[model samples]
Target: MMISLEYIYRYPIKGFPGERLEDARLNLAEGIVGDRKIGVGSGAMAVNQSGEWTPCQAFQRMTIRPDLTTFQVDRHDHILTLTAPSGRSETIDADTKQVEAGNPTVGDQLPVYRANGNKGYWDHPDAALSIINLSTVDAISQVIGQTIDPLRFRANIYIRAKPWSEFQWLGSQLSLGEAELDVIRPIDRCKTTSVNVKTGVADLNMPALLVRHFGHLYCGVYASVKKSGTIVPGASVKITGKSEDRIIEAAANAITAPALPDWPRPMRVSRTVEEATDIRSIWLEDPLAKTGSLSNFKAGQYIRIHNLAQTHTWRSYTVSAVDGSRLRITVKRDAGVGSQAMHSFNVGDNLTVSGPFGEATLSGKSKAHHFLTAGIGITPTVAKLRYLYAQGFVGKVRVTHVARTASELALWDDVVDAAKRLSGSSLELHLTKNVGDTVGAKLGRPDPSKLAEYAKSDKADVHICGPTTFVNSVMAALGSIDFDEEKIFLDTFSSPSVETEMRPIPASEPIRVTLQKSDITENWTPADGTLLDFAEARGVVISSNCRAGLCKSCSCKILSGSATRLVGEEGNDRRQTLVCSSIPSESIILEV
Candidate 1:
């Protein structure tokens, strides 16, 4: 079902360059262990801005020390000597390298990072955990109307045949099977992507696409380092997270011919809400219908509905009711495709509910204070507020509901009812129609003091669910207050930005993959489709994962003939290719 990585790409330099691998081992047990193990950190990372190396935040950067894919480092002084990929040896002393190579340096002294803190090149896990869904990437691009390189997110794992035609955000936890992960949160993008990963050149508009389509700069999921193990290319993937409903699975599974049993649970409509003229309450049906009671849920948990091909595409709503049999979900019918779709659903719908998911489930796992920023419809915020009130656990809690006018305040009466019902617990609601009060301007952005009013309360656990601007404003406000990152939970609805376009045809010549020892050569003509299709037809077994180059699967080593594919590895002569979708030139020989 996937592509096998015949080779791996290792980048010793953070943004400088990378090396190719004919043989590389995975330490899945250790998260991003060997990946990016050795990065030449200049005091700052500067993408080539306007054709010149620009100074970045931390340090000036270094390429794999001059064409060297594999390196042996000696950091005794502020100097480094590398055996470069070009096979031409050179010494890179901080000050001299920048001046000699004309590579600009932000500061005189740069921090040279070693992989696994080693001065020598060796094995390690991916520097950090990463996963990419080529199909998801494609879907996301379609919405944004741009071509997004999966590598921009820097994922270590790539998935295909996902249940949905859209890029799936975390509806449930994914079990790598071989490893454990503490997924932190979705990454917010930065200006870095504006700069090409390969060329270090800044493309201001590129970053804008991420925001316009992805809702944020980060397209990749950020996972905390947890368990590590061996991960082979072409390994099967299983999604095992709990959900607010099984709607995602239901919609996706409906489209998949031969059902994949491991689809994540779908989020359901809890109780319907008349929070706004365009909003309503949602009632979660069940994660696994009749599998178990729904009482396991804590307050502040959210669920998303997968509206495939319909008006409502996907929307994550907050839960209102606290009970198991029936939890409450609230949503606003914004004039968006996904929002419009959600407004059409009705009661008795066989919606599936998955979680009890999310790190900030307002549970005992986190002993900090809590902050809930409810804006606009405030349905999701009101749900958690009531749940916390019912629990009556002794802790400092603050709730801020912001709306344009009092009439637009959604469910303050219900929120007050929960606060009164809880009695003796710390719960306060702040409202504002202007800048001086509330979370920060009915229209202005959120700031530290304003954000801290909620986030700073007794080491609060902050939960934000709203449009892109609202979530971004809240996060920035909290950052200024130095709010604990672990406690901040954001539910930015996943939106597809780009629409896939017609890519130029791959090389006209057929691709040939030969297994030297086995003497098995697989040929794929454009007419016959991809090499993977050819291999599957002939029963040629080679590991493969993501059909796109996103995953390492189908990466091949060059034996002869210049092949057309993405550039890779130090000293890569352009020989290897991702056979899953790549077509080769005239006559070429490859190890299957």
Candidate 2:
């Protein structure tokens, strides 16, 4: 069969593994018909002060039986129950709304959680349901030159169809009953995808596959449920290839054969680290490493790391260049099943390794000084720093690192040596026990402004890697200081802050405006403020996805106004942005 349906599963919990399914009906604005409809309050996830969204990490220790798939927790009335796969149901009652919602409680208060071991956390609240296409998984493997399991690209439903053999045709269309969905865009891969859910090691194969092959390893497509109904596992899937069928085939063929450097591949490891805390740098030992040209890799870019124990839980972690022929990867232990299984690994254990994904690369072309910032985020920057230094880059170079303590520095000595090797280079260290008085720490997070301070001399080219929020703050702070956004390079986490800026013209001050593609022109004022508020008034229905700037669903470009992007990118300051949540800081021309 060209496209064959084999497995259907429902993960009642978000990140935790799930029970396979024979079928599940997609329902209106919800998933699996009645799935997650009635989860117990488990205690509310309280954020600073007046309850914000719950933090998923707060409930990490809650357990669920691997065999059970259905459960419920009622907080206000204090009720909980479980439906075992055996069909045996158990129930309990307790009035714990206060506890589930994280309200003030006396003594050892814990989150009231639901069973089934699934996390309900989503990047945003409206991620009601998700689906995956097996073809994409197959395609990613071809590009990165590695075999990736379908489950690594997790989704509630896995479709089998014509495009299953094709790499990216899922963006075209598929008929499931009578439903039609516009493939909004790719579901971008994340760092979470790289963490071996089972082992917590920085595994690096799947990501290498995507970054090397497809330009980006993102394979799955996100869809708005066009038609809702039950989806059974064995049910038939029909793919109507793209009308430009040859283009479809071309794209499909490309996923497996994307161009990249031939690696003196990293050697594979033969032993596993049994301890949970050990850094499992699984290598693909090439016999020539002792005397042969070693496989060279860049920093910040990651590789897919497989669980020698469970292939399904494979992940990616940034590659750190400890030497030319060999690579290093670090792991923070996971408390879940995936990490628990990785606990069986002992050093020298082997897991498949693919890539040398080039998420971070050298653009020595810029005549600007190289400002390398390192910390937890320096994995990629370290590679870049070493790459530049080894290439005899003599231009002005400086290294700035922020660490909690001197001893916590991972590879600090190596970086110091590298900085010394460069002619006229400078290395400045920023260590903080607290953000207390450090020019950096007090801000409470990383911001581009703080980074600019490290620039010290000229506004040199910048590259940053860190937590998404830290990166976001850096990007935002950098924008405020007028740093050339484009000059800044990144291998970053996508934070939903990339948005446009709009402003109101007082009713007495009429502003001339034009909508580029729509070819609409009008004089607008504060009376017709809010770009969305103004557009809808003018019958310019700016198509929007989430309207909250988080989804990047309504990204458009600015033709005129000096847009201060909500989510700042280094080189993209001159580009347009998300209009859904933008406020006009000035008169601007926009392209939708």
Candidate 3:
């Protein structure tokens, strides 16, 4: 049966009551035209001072003032009116007011403040719209043993659908009325959901209830407008095919078979050589080059390589050298399985290689280019230099390569040679250790003076890539030199570090993992590296690639409980976790 939109609501001011809408206009860039166009703030956390969006915690919310939900709000053009349950009313003009005078108070104690803006305010910067499933709300109500009001979720659109069916739409396109939206991720539930709309009381613990029932505290889905148009209540909704399958197939074929356009074609390793200490370079060519040559790629692009016969681990490496017949990738040996396996590759070895992807290439519109990198991060810069040398690019170019020691410089000679071939190009090498005039390179890390000199040009495009610390340092140095942030492009191979500390699940205290789609529950312990490993061992097929959590192929919604995502340094605010690196912190339910 087809799902239909049942309700539409818009919050003219964030952290306040929402107004029901009979119809709304969705824009590709801005979600609902007037939804959350302004936000309420108070004291030092005010948004008017900085003119930037602040987190919900900085402002007064329903969690702190449940009475705010009892206020009825309506909007007409630029004027907004608010009416209290006690028959008190206040009207304010949005366009002219910098701050409303003596605004409504919560519990007659805390004063409410408002921040006006034309640009929409949002929780997640990219997600402009949110949707919830009616059946899922009903199911949650049944589990909580209460008649739950869907308005507690504060979603823009409520759709009538099968219970938990909306989770399957992740990464898929949804056609609602004349507008199209791409479901990006599930909306993680917050303390706001605990506030009861009817009684104006924080009575229900929605997050705890969600964890008790689903494993993850998510109640709705966040979407981005793809094709903008008008949408109204009762409009039909259509979800496209499963996006998880497409991601899995693309990743698998990228390493095993040949898929055109999006997927990489199969190639054979023609040669391998140790370029420097702990560094290896491999040349790849189309096995069936007689039929057609390999696909052409612009400079600064990288390819994904995986050995299906060995393991599912895949790693991306920048194309160090490229030609009509073949391409080469330089690798720095690490403790990781992918790098170790790539280091063991011999000539004539069959391996799957996919697509020359990356956007930090030499911009055709740029009149000057500057590259800042360390160690293996210089691989893409080398490719760009080679392209410039071949094309006789006479524009100004500067490259700075930094390494702890001279031995760590993998492609020093190639970069020097390419710089000499380019008429106006220059290369500078820096050594953090081993400083001497005879070393033929600068001493210590990158200096701000060099970046300032390069950034003086209006048409200069700066690219930086390396370890997190190195990248951050270079960015800071660039900023000190007044470099344009918009012109800076970065490519880092490492994922953000996981911020949350997770204690290992005790072997004695087995964690129960329930897979919703398969209706199977498995007991797991610390011995299982991650939930993905445990699930796969039990023949519970889940899509996964880049087991290190860099690739989000294994990301799934946590229906209940919690999972420790061991990816990058950033903490996951979303309810979804990467199953490959996630260990169950408690008895968890996953909608994989």
Candidate 4:
């Protein structure tokens, strides 16, 4: 269904009150002009008025004093006026260093201090703007048996769309008037939404309501303005293709045929070392290393490797180590064809590898870094530790590596040696099957209590890389101990299975599939298999890699019609659908 922007609101002073706007200019770097340029701090909330940014909890919020929501705020250029429910009004210049209020005491005798900054004050560094769907709010109101006001969400933009449809826009670009916004991530609801805007009462429990109905505490979406322009109420909002589709299209148009430096580089395996019984490490060197043509990669990134001689086989492997002009990737023998081929690789073998992608690297700002890994997931951690050692990191660093057995601990010696070279760094090895208490070794998996002990400090960031089950379990354990999920980072080698079993499509009812861009039509039943399989069978070439859905190479825009994604998966959005695991629920039209 088509949706349009219905309302716009901007908060000049965070947690104070919002000002409605007929039209607002969005800036690429600063977001909505004059939006949250100042924040209010109180005695109970400590904030460094002269220093860098801090968390929103360190500032006065509506959750603590819902009375703030009862105040009406209006902004005109540099002048801001706040009118309380008692008809008492106060005017202050927004450019002034301090703002005075009619009632000095807001609630419970809390004195407010104005904290200003050049950049907008936001709950998240990247969340400069927020959008909430009116339909989602209505749906929640129905579930809660009350009329929910959109103002309670405190979003910058409110739009009328299908319930929960805003989530489909994630990783997509939205065009509102002349502005373009890149919807980054879902915004998790907090206690602030519980405050009633008109009555100034902590009435609705939005976070609890969301968690009870949606399995998560997310309500709205966070977006960054990509193009600067004016967005007004009643503007038509249009979403473009999914972000992955645009990325793939750009790469295809920029790079040509046989070989491109950034697309894939030809390399030769210079050395091979057996890390464990089923694990092996291969060192790759650029054939043109002398010319400085080899691409440099980050420490915690991975590369997709393809056998040069066997063009049909390729797989993604985490970079285990880096030296001079050589890159090393550790591989565990698996039943997969790519792993089998990698296991049979010999020195001097030629291979084509691409990318140093992934963002789970060590943050320079983090004083305490925790690395948790299981099985061959330790590969990336090895590169990270090596990088820390080279940088002479003095932070409190803890590494917990788990394996089925001690022999399966790939790169054990390298990790231990790196830990020894870095101050305040320690390595603990765990064997899931064995109960032997070796030095610096544990008998079982990671203990939540021990993890908490290591992470019990400020400025700590947790990096977790492992299989899906292992990572999920560790995340749950951390959550149980009240660890902030935001501080935890994850990189899983496998995507969650879309569905345990594919439902049989009835042959009696064939579904029509139309490639709107290509002007091609095909009929397919459940027996015909997935949309990707049917398209390939018809010689319709669609770029795809990692058919397991971890890589979004096969994502395409669903121009019209509906389709059913694999159970438990979120790819059912009409805007974007992954053809690999999607089945036509009706006559479907696709942009690909």
TM-score of each: 0.41, 0.38, 0.42, 0.42
Q: Rank the candidates by lDDT, best first.
A: 4, 3, 2, 1
Top lDDT prediction, candidate number: 4
lDDT of 4: 0.69
How many clashes does each candidate structure show, in the order listed? 106, 71, 13, 0
lDDT of 4 by residue, 1-592 (tens): 8889999988887887787889998888456876777665545344565534545655566745578887877877788777768777766677876534423434344333444454566776566789999988887787668998888889999999977667556557899998988876566565578788888886755654553433234677877777899999888999875454443233223321111223444467899999898999999985434333334456777776643222234466788877877888898998877788888878987665555555555766678789888988887777787777777778888888888877787888888887887788878888888745556677878775567556756457888888878887777777777897778877643211222233444454988999876677978887666787677555455665433343455688888887777633544557778786678878889997
RMSD of each: 21.2, 20.1, 19.7, 22.7
Return the lDDT, model 4, position 195. 80
Report lDDT (CA) for all predictions. Answer: 0.46, 0.47, 0.69, 0.69
Order by TM-score, highest first? 4, 3, 1, 2
Candidate 1 lDDT by residue in tens digits, 6-110: 223444445444444343343433444344443343432332322222222222222112112133333334454454334454455533323232222322344
lDDT of 3 at 105: 33
Error of 1 at 238 (Å): 3.5
lDDT of 3 at 356: 61
Taking the tens digit of each residue's C-alpha lDDT, what string does model 2 give over 356-450? 55444466665545444545565565566777877777677766656665444565566667677778577666665554443323322234565
> In terms of lDDT, which candidate is stronger, 3 or 4?
4
Which structure is stronger by lDDT: 1 or 4?
A: 4
Cα lDDT of candidate 2 equals: 0.47
